[model samples]
Target: MDSEVAREQALDAAEKLFYGRGVQAVGMDAVRTASGLSLKRLYQLFPAKEELVVAYLERRDLRWRGRIAEHVERHDDPQERIPAVFDWLEEWFGEADFRGCAWINSYGELGATSERVVAQVRAHKRAFRDYLAGLVTDAGLADVLAGQLFLLAEGAMVTAGITGSAEPAAEAREAARSLSRAN
Candidate 1:
Protein backbone atom coordinates (compact mmCIF):
# COMPACT_ATOMS: atom_id res chain seq x y z
CA MET A 1 0.00 0.00 0.00
CA ASP A 2 0.97 3.64 -0.37
CA SER A 3 2.40 5.65 2.51
CA GLU A 4 -0.86 7.54 3.14
CA VAL A 5 -2.96 4.38 3.28
CA ALA A 6 -0.40 2.62 5.41
CA ARG A 7 -0.29 5.50 7.84
CA GLU A 8 -4.06 5.61 8.17
CA GLN A 9 -4.25 1.86 8.60
CA ALA A 10 -1.58 1.97 11.28
CA LEU A 11 -3.45 4.77 13.01
CA ASP A 12 -6.70 2.82 12.97
CA ALA A 13 -5.13 -0.25 14.52
CA ALA A 14 -3.13 1.78 16.99
CA GLU A 15 -6.17 3.71 18.16
CA LYS A 16 -8.29 0.63 18.88
CA LEU A 17 -5.55 -1.41 20.49
CA PHE A 18 -3.95 1.46 22.30
CA TYR A 19 -7.21 2.84 23.65
CA GLY A 20 -9.15 -0.37 24.27
CA ARG A 21 -6.25 -2.54 25.34
CA GLY A 22 -3.88 0.08 26.74
CA VAL A 23 -0.74 1.52 25.14
CA GLN A 24 1.65 -0.71 27.07
CA ALA A 25 -0.20 -3.95 26.37
CA VAL A 26 -0.57 -3.42 22.60
CA GLY A 27 2.88 -3.78 21.07
CA MET A 28 4.01 -2.51 17.68
CA ASP A 29 3.94 -6.01 16.22
CA ALA A 30 0.31 -6.33 17.22
CA VAL A 31 -0.50 -3.08 15.50
CA ARG A 32 1.28 -4.29 12.39
CA THR A 33 -0.58 -7.57 12.43
CA ALA A 34 -3.88 -5.85 13.02
CA SER A 35 -3.26 -3.52 10.10
CA GLY A 36 -1.92 -6.29 7.86
CA LEU A 37 1.17 -4.23 7.39
CA SER A 38 4.75 -5.28 7.76
CA LEU A 39 6.95 -4.16 10.64
CA LYS A 40 9.13 -2.15 8.26
CA ARG A 41 6.09 -0.41 6.82
CA LEU A 42 4.76 0.45 10.25
CA TYR A 43 8.12 1.85 11.31
CA GLN A 44 8.35 3.86 8.13
CA LEU A 45 5.05 5.47 9.03
CA PHE A 46 5.35 5.96 12.79
CA PRO A 47 9.13 5.76 13.49
CA ALA A 48 8.23 5.05 17.15
CA LYS A 49 5.26 3.92 19.19
CA GLU A 50 5.19 7.41 20.64
CA GLU A 51 4.61 8.86 17.21
CA LEU A 52 1.86 6.36 16.51
CA VAL A 53 0.26 7.18 19.85
CA VAL A 54 0.37 10.88 19.07
CA ALA A 55 -1.39 10.13 15.80
CA TYR A 56 -4.02 8.08 17.62
CA LEU A 57 -4.80 10.92 19.99
CA GLU A 58 -4.91 13.38 17.11
CA ARG A 59 -7.29 11.17 15.17
CA ARG A 60 -9.60 10.75 18.15
CA ASP A 61 -9.47 14.43 19.00
CA LEU A 62 -10.21 15.52 15.45
CA ARG A 63 -13.28 13.29 15.30
CA TRP A 64 -14.78 14.34 18.64
CA ARG A 65 -13.71 17.98 18.68
CA GLY A 66 -15.20 18.73 15.29
CA ARG A 67 -18.49 17.20 16.31
CA ILE A 68 -18.41 19.09 19.60
CA ALA A 69 -17.81 22.41 17.88
CA GLU A 70 -20.73 21.66 15.56
CA HIS A 71 -22.97 20.82 18.48
CA VAL A 72 -21.91 23.96 20.31
CA GLU A 73 -22.83 26.07 17.32
CA ARG A 74 -26.21 24.42 16.81
CA HIS A 75 -27.78 26.44 19.58
CA ASP A 76 -27.62 30.13 20.42
CA ASP A 77 -28.95 30.01 23.95
CA PRO A 78 -26.09 29.61 26.41
CA GLN A 79 -28.38 27.59 28.62
CA GLU A 80 -28.85 25.22 25.72
CA ARG A 81 -25.09 25.07 25.31
CA ILE A 82 -24.09 23.08 28.39
CA PRO A 83 -26.82 20.53 27.80
CA ALA A 84 -25.60 19.98 24.26
CA VAL A 85 -22.44 18.50 25.73
CA PHE A 86 -24.35 16.02 27.87
CA ASP A 87 -26.62 15.20 24.93
CA TRP A 88 -23.59 14.30 22.88
CA LEU A 89 -22.23 12.17 25.72
CA GLU A 90 -25.53 10.32 26.13
CA GLU A 91 -25.61 9.58 22.44
CA TRP A 92 -21.98 8.46 22.23
CA PHE A 93 -21.97 6.44 25.46
CA GLY A 94 -25.08 4.63 24.20
CA GLU A 95 -23.08 3.15 21.33
CA ALA A 96 -22.65 -0.63 21.22
CA ASP A 97 -18.86 -0.32 21.34
CA PHE A 98 -19.08 2.13 24.16
CA ARG A 99 -16.11 1.59 26.45
CA GLY A 100 -16.48 4.92 28.14
CA CYS A 101 -14.19 7.83 27.20
CA ALA A 102 -11.29 6.39 25.23
CA TRP A 103 -8.97 9.09 26.53
CA ILE A 104 -9.63 8.49 30.21
CA ASN A 105 -9.50 4.73 29.85
CA SER A 106 -6.20 5.05 28.05
CA TYR A 107 -4.93 7.27 30.84
CA GLY A 108 -5.93 4.74 33.47
CA GLU A 109 -4.42 1.89 31.53
CA LEU A 110 -1.13 3.76 31.05
CA GLY A 111 -1.04 5.71 34.30
CA ALA A 112 1.63 8.49 34.14
CA THR A 113 4.28 6.38 32.44
CA SER A 114 3.90 7.32 28.80
CA GLU A 115 4.92 10.94 28.58
CA ARG A 116 3.77 11.26 24.98
CA VAL A 117 0.31 9.83 25.60
CA VAL A 118 0.00 11.78 28.83
CA ALA A 119 0.81 15.03 27.04
CA GLN A 120 -1.68 14.22 24.31
CA VAL A 121 -4.31 13.48 26.93
CA ARG A 122 -3.56 16.69 28.77
CA ALA A 123 -3.89 18.70 25.57
CA HIS A 124 -7.27 17.12 24.91
CA LYS A 125 -8.33 17.93 28.45
CA ARG A 126 -7.35 21.53 27.91
CA ALA A 127 -9.34 21.61 24.71
CA PHE A 128 -12.37 20.41 26.63
CA ARG A 129 -11.86 22.99 29.35
CA ASP A 130 -11.38 25.72 26.78
CA TYR A 131 -14.50 24.59 24.98
CA LEU A 132 -16.48 24.92 28.18
CA ALA A 133 -14.83 28.25 28.86
CA GLY A 134 -15.97 29.46 25.47
CA LEU A 135 -19.55 28.53 26.26
CA VAL A 136 -19.37 30.27 29.61
CA THR A 137 -17.82 33.36 28.09
CA ASP A 138 -20.46 33.44 25.41
CA ALA A 139 -23.13 33.22 28.05
CA GLY A 140 -21.60 35.96 30.20
CA LEU A 141 -21.10 33.59 33.08
CA ALA A 142 -18.86 34.23 36.02
CA ASP A 143 -15.35 32.81 35.59
CA VAL A 144 -15.45 30.94 38.89
CA LEU A 145 -18.76 29.32 38.04
CA ALA A 146 -17.51 28.50 34.57
CA GLY A 147 -14.50 26.78 36.10
CA GLN A 148 -16.77 24.82 38.43
CA LEU A 149 -19.03 23.72 35.60
CA PHE A 150 -16.03 22.63 33.58
CA LEU A 151 -14.70 20.48 36.42
CA LEU A 152 -18.17 19.13 37.10
CA ALA A 153 -18.53 17.98 33.50
CA GLU A 154 -15.06 16.43 33.67
CA GLY A 155 -15.86 14.65 36.93
CA ALA A 156 -19.02 13.30 35.37
CA MET A 157 -17.11 11.86 32.42
CA VAL A 158 -14.62 10.19 34.75
CA THR A 159 -17.47 8.76 36.82
CA ALA A 160 -19.18 7.32 33.76
CA GLY A 161 -15.93 5.72 32.68
CA ILE A 162 -15.39 4.17 36.11
CA THR A 163 -18.90 2.67 36.30
CA GLY A 164 -19.20 1.64 32.61
CA SER A 165 -22.52 3.45 32.78
CA ALA A 166 -23.87 6.86 31.75
CA GLU A 167 -25.93 7.65 34.81
CA PRO A 168 -23.42 10.33 35.71
CA ALA A 169 -24.16 12.05 32.44
CA ALA A 170 -27.81 12.37 33.38
CA GLU A 171 -26.81 13.59 36.79
CA ALA A 172 -24.53 16.11 35.11
CA ARG A 173 -27.36 17.31 32.89
CA GLU A 174 -29.69 17.84 35.81
CA ALA A 175 -27.00 19.72 37.67
CA ALA A 176 -26.20 21.78 34.59
CA ARG A 177 -29.85 22.64 34.06
CA SER A 178 -30.17 23.82 37.62
CA LEU A 179 -27.04 25.91 37.28
CA SER A 180 -28.22 27.35 34.01
CA ARG A 181 -31.43 28.47 35.62
CA ALA A 182 -29.48 30.11 38.39
CA ASN A 183 -27.55 32.04 35.80
Candidate 2:
Protein backbone atom coordinates (compact mmCIF):
# COMPACT_ATOMS: atom_id res chain seq x y z
CA MET A 1 0.00 0.00 0.00
CA ASP A 2 1.01 3.61 -0.45
CA SER A 3 2.23 5.70 2.46
CA GLU A 4 -1.04 7.67 2.82
CA VAL A 5 -3.16 4.52 2.72
CA ALA A 6 -0.90 2.85 5.22
CA ARG A 7 -1.14 5.86 7.50
CA GLU A 8 -4.96 5.81 7.34
CA GLN A 9 -5.03 2.06 7.93
CA ALA A 10 -2.83 2.45 10.99
CA LEU A 11 -5.04 5.21 12.37
CA ASP A 12 -8.19 3.19 11.73
CA ALA A 13 -6.80 0.28 13.71
CA ALA A 14 -5.39 2.49 16.41
CA GLU A 15 -8.73 4.26 16.91
CA LYS A 16 -10.64 1.00 17.15
CA LEU A 17 -8.24 -0.57 19.64
CA PHE A 18 -7.57 2.57 21.65
CA TYR A 19 -11.23 3.49 22.04
CA GLY A 20 -12.58 -0.04 22.39
CA ARG A 21 -10.03 -0.89 25.02
CA GLY A 22 -8.05 1.47 27.14
CA VAL A 23 -5.07 2.95 25.34
CA GLN A 24 -2.64 1.39 27.80
CA ALA A 25 -4.19 -2.03 27.34
CA VAL A 26 -3.46 -2.17 23.61
CA GLY A 27 0.07 -2.55 22.25
CA MET A 28 1.58 -1.42 18.98
CA ASP A 29 1.68 -5.00 17.80
CA ALA A 30 -2.09 -5.12 18.19
CA VAL A 31 -2.44 -2.11 15.91
CA ARG A 32 0.01 -3.71 13.53
CA THR A 33 -2.00 -6.88 13.46
CA ALA A 34 -5.30 -5.07 13.12
CA SER A 35 -4.04 -2.86 10.35
CA GLY A 36 -2.27 -5.70 8.55
CA LEU A 37 0.80 -3.47 8.38
CA SER A 38 4.31 -4.48 9.26
CA LEU A 39 5.99 -3.22 12.40
CA LYS A 40 8.49 -1.19 10.39
CA ARG A 41 5.78 0.61 8.44
CA LEU A 42 3.76 1.34 11.55
CA TYR A 43 6.80 2.82 13.20
CA GLN A 44 7.61 4.76 10.08
CA LEU A 45 4.17 6.40 10.23
CA PHE A 46 4.07 6.90 13.98
CA PRO A 47 7.48 7.04 15.61
CA ALA A 48 6.03 6.48 19.07
CA LYS A 49 2.84 5.20 20.62
CA GLU A 50 2.15 8.70 21.81
CA GLU A 51 2.26 9.94 18.21
CA LEU A 52 -0.25 7.30 17.23
CA VAL A 53 -2.50 8.31 20.08
CA VAL A 54 -2.29 11.94 19.02
CA ALA A 55 -3.20 11.11 15.44
CA TYR A 56 -6.13 8.99 16.57
CA LEU A 57 -7.45 11.86 18.68
CA GLU A 58 -6.99 14.48 15.97
CA ARG A 59 -8.83 12.42 13.37
CA ARG A 60 -11.64 11.45 15.73
CA ASP A 61 -12.19 15.05 16.79
CA LEU A 62 -12.64 16.27 13.24
CA ARG A 63 -14.83 13.36 12.24
CA TRP A 64 -17.04 13.54 15.33
CA ARG A 65 -17.68 17.26 15.05
CA GLY A 66 -18.32 17.03 11.34
CA ARG A 67 -20.90 14.32 11.90
CA ILE A 68 -22.67 16.38 14.54
CA ALA A 69 -22.66 19.47 12.36
CA GLU A 70 -24.08 17.57 9.45
CA HIS A 71 -26.79 16.10 11.60
CA VAL A 72 -27.77 19.45 13.06
CA GLU A 73 -27.81 21.11 9.67
CA ARG A 74 -30.46 18.72 8.49
CA HIS A 75 -33.07 20.67 10.39
CA ASP A 76 -34.43 23.96 9.06
CA ASP A 77 -35.89 25.53 12.16
CA PRO A 78 -33.41 27.39 14.32
CA GLN A 79 -35.06 26.18 17.51
CA GLU A 80 -35.22 22.68 16.16
CA ARG A 81 -31.56 22.81 15.25
CA ILE A 82 -30.62 23.23 18.89
CA PRO A 83 -32.53 20.13 19.89
CA ALA A 84 -31.13 18.40 16.84
CA VAL A 85 -27.82 18.37 18.64
CA PHE A 86 -29.26 16.06 21.28
CA ASP A 87 -31.04 14.09 18.58
CA TRP A 88 -27.68 13.38 17.06
CA LEU A 89 -26.27 12.44 20.44
CA GLU A 90 -29.09 9.99 20.99
CA GLU A 91 -28.35 8.23 17.73
CA TRP A 92 -24.65 8.15 18.54
CA PHE A 93 -25.29 6.60 21.95
CA GLY A 94 -27.43 3.91 20.36
CA GLU A 95 -24.69 2.67 18.08
CA ALA A 96 -23.50 -0.88 18.74
CA ASP A 97 -19.99 0.25 19.61
CA PHE A 98 -21.00 3.37 21.49
CA ARG A 99 -18.17 4.26 23.88
CA GLY A 100 -19.05 7.75 25.13
CA CYS A 101 -17.06 10.84 24.25
CA ALA A 102 -13.69 9.80 22.89
CA TRP A 103 -12.02 12.81 24.45
CA ILE A 104 -13.49 12.03 27.84
CA ASN A 105 -12.51 8.37 27.56
CA SER A 106 -9.03 9.26 26.41
CA TYR A 107 -8.64 11.69 29.29
CA GLY A 108 -9.67 9.10 31.81
CA GLU A 109 -7.25 6.58 30.35
CA LEU A 110 -4.12 8.62 29.64
CA GLY A 111 -4.46 12.32 30.42
CA ALA A 112 -2.44 12.19 33.63
CA THR A 113 0.47 10.35 32.06
CA SER A 114 0.42 11.94 28.61
CA GLU A 115 0.41 15.67 28.10
CA ARG A 116 -0.27 15.23 24.40
CA VAL A 117 -3.37 13.26 25.26
CA VAL A 118 -4.34 15.92 27.77
CA ALA A 119 -3.93 18.68 25.20
CA GLN A 120 -5.91 16.79 22.58
CA VAL A 121 -8.79 16.22 25.00
CA ARG A 122 -8.80 19.84 26.08
CA ALA A 123 -8.68 21.11 22.53
CA HIS A 124 -11.53 18.87 21.41
CA LYS A 125 -13.67 19.96 24.37
CA ARG A 126 -12.94 23.63 23.84
CA ALA A 127 -13.86 23.34 20.20
CA PHE A 128 -17.09 21.56 21.09
CA ARG A 129 -18.00 24.25 23.58
CA ASP A 130 -17.26 26.91 21.00
CA TYR A 131 -19.48 25.09 18.54
CA LEU A 132 -22.29 25.16 21.05
CA ALA A 133 -21.72 28.84 21.59
CA GLY A 134 -22.12 29.41 17.89
CA LEU A 135 -25.42 27.58 17.88
CA VAL A 136 -26.64 29.59 20.84
CA THR A 137 -25.71 32.80 19.10
CA ASP A 138 -27.39 31.76 15.88
CA ALA A 139 -30.54 30.84 17.74
CA GLY A 140 -30.61 34.29 19.33
CA LEU A 141 -30.58 32.74 22.79
CA ALA A 142 -28.89 34.14 25.84
CA ASP A 143 -25.10 33.79 25.95
CA VAL A 144 -25.32 31.81 29.18
CA LEU A 145 -27.51 29.28 27.41
CA ALA A 146 -24.46 28.17 25.45
CA GLY A 147 -22.66 27.06 28.58
CA GLN A 148 -25.76 25.35 29.92
CA LEU A 149 -26.31 23.47 26.66
CA PHE A 150 -22.70 22.40 26.52
CA LEU A 151 -22.91 21.03 30.07
CA LEU A 152 -26.18 19.29 29.29
CA ALA A 153 -24.66 17.57 26.27
CA GLU A 154 -21.55 16.48 28.16
CA GLY A 155 -23.62 15.26 31.07
CA ALA A 156 -25.77 13.23 28.70
CA MET A 157 -22.72 11.56 27.17
CA VAL A 158 -21.33 10.63 30.59
CA THR A 159 -24.70 9.47 31.86
CA ALA A 160 -25.40 7.36 28.81
CA GLY A 161 -21.94 5.85 28.89
CA ILE A 162 -22.19 4.95 32.55
CA THR A 163 -25.76 3.67 32.56
CA GLY A 164 -25.76 2.09 29.09
CA SER A 165 -28.87 4.01 28.17
CA ALA A 166 -29.55 6.61 25.49
CA GLU A 167 -32.35 8.37 27.34
CA PRO A 168 -30.10 11.07 28.69
CA ALA A 169 -29.94 12.65 25.25
CA ALA A 170 -33.68 13.16 25.20
CA GLU A 171 -33.63 14.34 28.80
CA ALA A 172 -30.93 16.83 28.01
CA ARG A 173 -32.86 18.05 25.00
CA GLU A 174 -35.87 18.77 27.18
CA ALA A 175 -33.70 20.67 29.60
CA ALA A 176 -32.19 22.63 26.76
CA ARG A 177 -35.66 23.49 25.48
CA SER A 178 -36.75 24.66 28.91
CA LEU A 179 -33.63 26.76 29.29
CA SER A 180 -34.02 28.23 25.85
CA ARG A 181 -37.58 29.22 26.64
CA ALA A 182 -36.52 30.89 29.89
CA ASN A 183 -34.03 32.90 27.88
Report the number of the highest-lDDT candidate: 2
In candidate 2, residue 134 scores what lDDT?
90
Candidate 1 regions off by >4 Å?
A: none
TM-score versus the correct structure, for each prediction: 0.91, 0.98
- Shift in Å, residue 180, candidate 1: 2.5
Residue-level lDDT for 61 in candidate 2: 95
**Once model 2 is optimally superposed onto the true structure by TM-score, how far is the C-alpha of residue 116 displaced, in angstroms?**
1.0
TM-score of 1: 0.91
Q: How close to the true structure is residue 48 of candidate 1, measured as C-alpha lDDT?
A: 86
Candidate 2 TM-score, true structure as reference: 0.98
Per-residue alpha-carbon lDDT of model 2 for 1-183, expressed as tens digits? Answer: 899999999999999999898788999999999999999999999999999999999999999999999999998878788999999999999998988888898889888899999999999999999999998888988999999999999999999998889999999999999999999
Residue-pair clash count for candidate 1: 0
Q: Write one digit per residue (lDDT tens) for candidate 1, span 1-183.
A: 788988899998988787677778899999999999999999988898878877888899989889877876798887688888887776766666666676787677664778877888888988888888888778887666576677777777777766778788788888877887677
Residue runs of model 2 more than 4 Å from their true location after superposition:
none
Residue-pair clash count for candidate 2: 0
